[model samples]
Target: MSNATQTDRWTDSPRARWLAVAVYAVAMAWVESAVVLYLRTLTQRLDPATTTPLPPLERVTEAELVREAATLIMLGAVGWLAGRDRRTRAGYGLLAFGLWDIFYYVFLKPLTSWPRSLLDWDVLFLLPLPWWGPVAAPVSVALLMVLWGSLVTQLPPQRLQRSPPGLVWVLTALGVVLALYVFMADAIRVAPQGRQALQNLLPTRFNWLLFGCAWLLMATPVLHLLIQLTRRQPAQPTASQPE
Candidate 1:
């Protein structure tokens, strides 16, 4: 084949899946950051660490919350399309989420000097409730997701044949719930008073120990998978070979 044809084939190959996902994630993150920039510009809540981080409820309408939900759906759809099976689909989803999250900060730093440091706090999500955490928190999780997702997606098929048990998933789900609780603790505390109270609240402390435990628990399946892959033995010869 000609060099050009070879290049094209390589670009279309399975090995290039990560590249495609990364490109799409970067673009999505850029667009999302731009949207946030516009919103901050409009609301004048540019610095997330200020006393009043979130805009008044009037300024942040239901539409904005809906848009966030829509973004998640879109991310999930991209993963579904990129992966060949459920596990790989989940890997792609994590890959997309991780890249989008990391690049959200990357694209934001240039536009808004917010998140001055990794320790800077911000409002994370608003589905069941508003999640609050330092920039380092989600970034740390995203990095782990990238690592796990890469392993899941790039490992040889034979290495991935050993599926994680149901107990592992249960532990993972518990870990997720614990982590969410940690993030939403402040918001939940103020929720009874209403949106204003919740928005006005600033998190004073983060339970790092609990978060660490949760993070390690969440990593169980990935670690187990890796162990299995490592312990996997080569198939033995079906017949004796002549010396």
Candidate 2:
């Protein structure tokens, strides 16, 4: 079938949906960065590398944790609403998350001149524990999320573009575990002491070697997609677009 015919055959096209998702994610990121800016300004700890957690330590920490969880749900809900199936729903979630993260930093640039470089260390998350890593790590992972998500959503569901195998998922899970471990090792070590110990973490350096391995493993599905794409037959020319 012609490319136009194939695209038109779909009852609900992901291309149009992708645009909506992208706009939503970008706006969400702006709000997230603004919120962080306010919190940091309140704490007088605007530096990304600072060891300071939010003030009124216990209450603020609880609030921040809840906010982070709420953000995830909001992102996932948009994905759930946009997709036709479970797989595509997951794709939209990942895509929205990746866009939100990258743009969070983008929006932060003007609000605060923090993260002078990609290598700047950042306190990435605070759910079960404090997750710390360089800005580059999450950005790289976000790029991977975007790649895999686009493939899952935009690629035609045909033999030419099949779902990744079980092994790909296993490797991806392994990668996620490794990355989380790397991000939370400091906090984990201090857990024996108490919350006070975790609150005092500075995180002097990041384990790039381990994170690199994790990133490669996390890229399993993308690698599989590339292999499938290389074996695909060349695309037929389509009708020209209007001027």
Candidate 3:
């Protein structure tokens, strides 16, 4: 077979598809773990007393960005492979995110035993809110991603209905807003705090509620789609109708 045909055959095969995803995930985890280790070392080297109050936007070194970018490029390749089939791409994306997430924690255990428990604090992401919580927080999100992926991939093609593009845009916007609220919560609380207080002013109870509500909202689209897929259908009319 030609090289292109051989490549196509491998990607189309179930075993190859899964193996590719697993390898991609492992590479991503390794890169992330290494970057984190380097960052911790950098942090230790810095003089905490003399460092500026605000973190630098380019704190991550050029080498680190190159490594991270390579990992992301690999992830995008896996996404492209997984998304080859429209029927199952959503499922692939969901599984890709979840597995990548869970394995990141798994690989980090040996590199640095930081999170001893599920409640250990973590910076989930860097964008707006920097998600903070125990290890369980992202794990929960990963599980949800898996659920959404399974639902998307398993549904029959006949049952799949696209929501209005406007509705999709609305949901996407709401999701971003909710995510920001959850992430910047600490910053929001600090706005009213006294000098030298590095803590968030928001009550723990409120934070928990907000987090729970945000998660539920994220799950809504997937849940609705799943219901549509699983619902029993009525029999179709016969060709021999009464005259």
Candidate 4:
């Protein structure tokens, strides 16, 4: 086979898959941004951190929450349809999420232009409680997700099979817990005040120090894998001697 034909075969399938996933994410992000813009405009929450929903539209929260949940399910379904194996499916899901989130912010710019800079504060989510943080925080994590996802999804079989150490997993969980705490600190503090308080809570400051540590801890496994790949020696293809 010619080099071009060989290069276009199975060897390139992962790249093709990655491109397709990215395309889906970007297209979905445009739609999500438009929907969010309309919702926020209606709620007068274009500035979610400080703007309380208009009194008449207060009930929109429940539907907004459901839409967020549905978006996640759609992203996950993209992974399920795109990959043949569990690991690849998971990787694609992560990739899709990271791309979608990052692009959501990107597309929202022209529609609203609210996040004037990276440090601008925003409400990240509305789950068990509200999540609040600077725009930079989630974007940083999203970039890491993209890196780790690309690595696992496109890597050779030998590298992909070598999972990170247990300690790495421990650090990952700890990091996630810490990050969540930081994001929800404001909401958690106001919980005793009642649901109305939660609805109107607005965080003015971010705990960057703690969040920075969490981000580093979360990065351990990805760094470890990268080191392994760099130090790995190429295989010698001698049948009998295995050299």
Candidate 5:
């Protein structure tokens, strides 16, 4: 079949859905990277380790925060459109987010050469609060998301397990809290002094031990599903052909 015909044939299949989502995320990541390059260049914060890092409160602006929230909404919308149900929708969202994040840094390296090393610190997000971490941290999470999302997307419904129970969810939430604490700990520490303190704060360290524990905790559901799928697989028959 021709390429176009083949695409049309599998357009609604999980494979096509994932492919289209990946393409869209890559293009969107370029746009995201370009926008950040412009902002950082304007603010002179591209280096990230300058005497003063990150823009001031006025320079960062409420408008920019709104834009971040909108970016998340756009990502979620793509997943919602791509999948037939909740599990697949979440899978596609995670896939898109992971690819977008990884490619953002990939594109940025050639454009700005800012993160000299994976250990370089950067302001990862600004939502209800600012999230800060080294380049390696989010990239690690993104890798996990990509792997988990791929499995969730490609597996048939019967092979998939249901969502975790309430206690598992509580643990997941705790994991999220721990990870966020690692990312935003500095900001939280300076919060008593207000926004200026936070803007001026530079992270001196990262809690790798806590982060590792949290990563494992967040992966609980994925581990459970994997075990379930493995147990369900049929055993191979021994070679015993008749004459």
Candidate 6:
């Protein structure tokens, strides 16, 4: 087949693209679930509410780092696979991430009905900030993921005219900072009371405002990129041009 024909054949095959997405989602889900199960086994002895004094910075475990690295690798691989074409891949990545997260909860519910409501507290991360929030928090994020995924997947391909990288990056960073602040606000307030009292501090209304702001900030880039991609154009000049 000619190169043009082969390229057209590949891009036109939506079935293949979607099948690949399914396989990737299942594989990644299995890996993630297994790792999480193992971690739970290891930390089973620790009480969720227990607040021990923070360990010395030097004493942090390699196991923790490895787990984090593994998780990133799994997520990154999905993006890498999908990003074969920038626009297509962004869509695929967004959809994959969003679906994976949503289904994680769906599958977990059968095993343990822990998050019975949107207000149930859950750990959102384990890094420096260690995000903690209600189920509604991540669900809201998943909704954004769906919006971003739809935009990326459904829009026509085009080169980014504006290249709003600086704006995008700034918004992304602000979002992360805001998320961290909101999650850790309770911990921060309780820090003055000493480590022993930290467990009693829960997220507050102000944190919810911060979370809302952060969520909107994070979504700005995706929305902007989508709008740019979907903007319509006037028809190009035909062979008969006004002279």
Candidate 4 Cα deviation (angstroms), residue 142:
0.4
Q: Candidate 4 lDDT, tens digit per residue, 1-243?
A: 998898778545988888999999999999989998998887677766665522334468777788889989999999888777887887888899999989999999889987788888888888878899999999999888888878888897676545567898899889999999999998999999988888777788899999999999989868977887888677878768654
Write model 2 residue lDDT over 1-243, tens digit each, in one string.
898887775635788888889899999999999999998888898885665453446788888999999999999999999888888898998999999999999999889998888888888999889899889999999999888888888888763344568998999999999999999998898889977777777788788999999999999988988888779577788999999
**lDDT by candidate, in order shown:** 0.85, 0.87, 0.60, 0.85, 0.83, 0.62
Q: Candidate 5 on 165-211: residue-level lDDT in tens? A: 77766877788889999998888888899877777778878999999
Report the C-alpha lDDT of model 1 over 1-243, residue by residue, as the tens digit: 899999998876556887898889999999989998998888787776667777676646577889899989988888788888888888888989999999999989999988789988878887778888998999988887887888888887777665788988899999999999999998888999997887678887899999999898888877878787779588876987899
Candidate 4 runs further than 4 Å off: 1-12, 53-58, 240-243
Name the candidate that leads on TM-score. 1
All candidates: TM-score: 0.91, 0.89, 0.67, 0.90, 0.89, 0.69
lDDT score for residue 197 of model 5? 78
Q: What RMSD does model 3 have?
A: 6.4
Clashing pairs in 4: none
Where model 6 places Cα greater than 4 Å from the true spot, the runs are 1-15, 34-65, 85-92, 159-162, 187-206, 239-243
Superposition error at 129 for model 3 (Å): 6.1
Q: Quick one: RMSD of model 5?
A: 3.9
**Candidate 2 global lDDT:** 0.87
Q: Count clashes in each candidate, considering only residues at least 3 apart in sequence or on different chains.
A: 0, 0, 3, 0, 0, 1
Worst 10 residues of 4 by lDDT: 49-58
What lDDT does candidate 4 reach at residue 127? 83
- In terms of lDDT, the poorest run of 10 residues in model 1 is 52-61
Among these predicted structures, which one has the highest lDDT? 2
Error of 5 at 4 (Å): 8.7
How does residue 143 of candidate 2 score in lDDT?
A: 94
Tens digits of per-residue lDDT for model 6, 1-243: 899999888865644565566567656665655555455445551222223322323334356656666766666567567555665676677667666666666655543444566776665555643457776877778667756765555554543542456877699779968977887776766677864455344454546887999999978868787767677765777797788
lDDT of predicted model 3: 0.60
